[model samples]
Target: MARPPRFDTDQLLDAAVRLAAEGGPAAVTMAAVAQAVGAPSGSVYHRFSGRTTLLAEVWLRTVERFQEGYFAALTDASPPSGGAGGPGPDPARAAARAAARHVVVWSRAHRDEATLLLYGAQDFGRAEWSEEHIRRADSGNARVFASIGGLAADLGAADERGRDRVVLALIDLPLSLVRRHLRAGEPLPPHAEDLAEECTAALLR
Candidate 1:
């Protein structure tokens, strides 16, 4: 029987994540990743075709992980009552709070990954990736917008366009705030989470 693969894909990716986090995408060359993981360069090539493929995989994996955690938190925060007799929590408030907290907490916890993802452009160079990857990114973004739209409608925002503006403001404002702190070489503002939550609430209202 053929033997199973020796190195774990997750382990390799974790090392790559740390490297990218510490040194940016430019630090994620195959040689660098291999050195970081103490693995032979051939191992990286065996798993990924090239630098583009490896970087794409790392970027997509990081985004997916964040999305999964945020969505799970939203589900968990759901109210224990209502909604078709299912045990799931009421999604409205829970979803909003969870979304806000998720972005703030995840960004702070993985500042390197966040910075790499937001700032580093993954140059696919016309290489076609799996449709699933595209869908995953789109769907996660859509969910955030949908949640914001629902909240805006609840608060009687003038229209869909108005709701979209509010959504953009809520999401982008916090990220910009964090980016400013990082750029200034200052510690993240202690009230960052509070600011996000308050901004989200106000937009919804």
Candidate 2:
């Protein structure tokens, strides 16, 4: 019988994420990951076919984690017996607001992973895997945006297109702000959180 896997995939991924966060995606080589995890290079290969695969996995995992938190916040605040619990007044609006807030908070907390996921693209030298990855990513993002847009419309945003623009603005602006802060070697602005909250409220309103 084949030997069961020894090292934990999550642990290895954690190390890989740290390396990428510290040194960018190029730092996540098989040798680097192996070194970080104290595993043999062969073990890295055993876990992933190669560097591209490892990078793809890292990006996917990070996105999955972010989506989980986002969806949870959306669901928690949604009204029962509604369409996908579409955002409504009172608690639903509050929940949508909270979800928007969580997006910034989560991005800040997982800056490295968020950065990688935002920028990483899957390479499918293998045609089948490439197509599969593209389809899944496109579909997943559409669903996420649809949910966000629904909430925005419910909260009185102009229309689907308008809501989408607002969602993109809210999501991308904070990321850009974070990137700028990091580049300048400055601390997160004292009013950054409040600013993001205000931005969300204005865009939604």
Please report the candidate that would top lDDT against the real structure.
2
lDDT of each: 0.66, 0.66
Mind giving the per-residue lDDT tens digits that candidate 1 earns over 94-187?
4555566567778888776666566533443214555665676577768755656665564456776776755654566657767787656566
**Residues 94-166, model 2: lDDT tens digits:** 5555666666677678766755554545432223345555576566677677777666665667866776756
Query: C-alpha displacement of 93 in model 2, angstroms?
Result: 3.8
Off by over 4 Å in 1: 1-6, 72-94, 120-132, 158-161
Candidate 2 structure, TM-score to reference: 0.76
Best by TM-score: 2
- Residue 63 in candidate 2, Cα distance off native in Å: 1.0
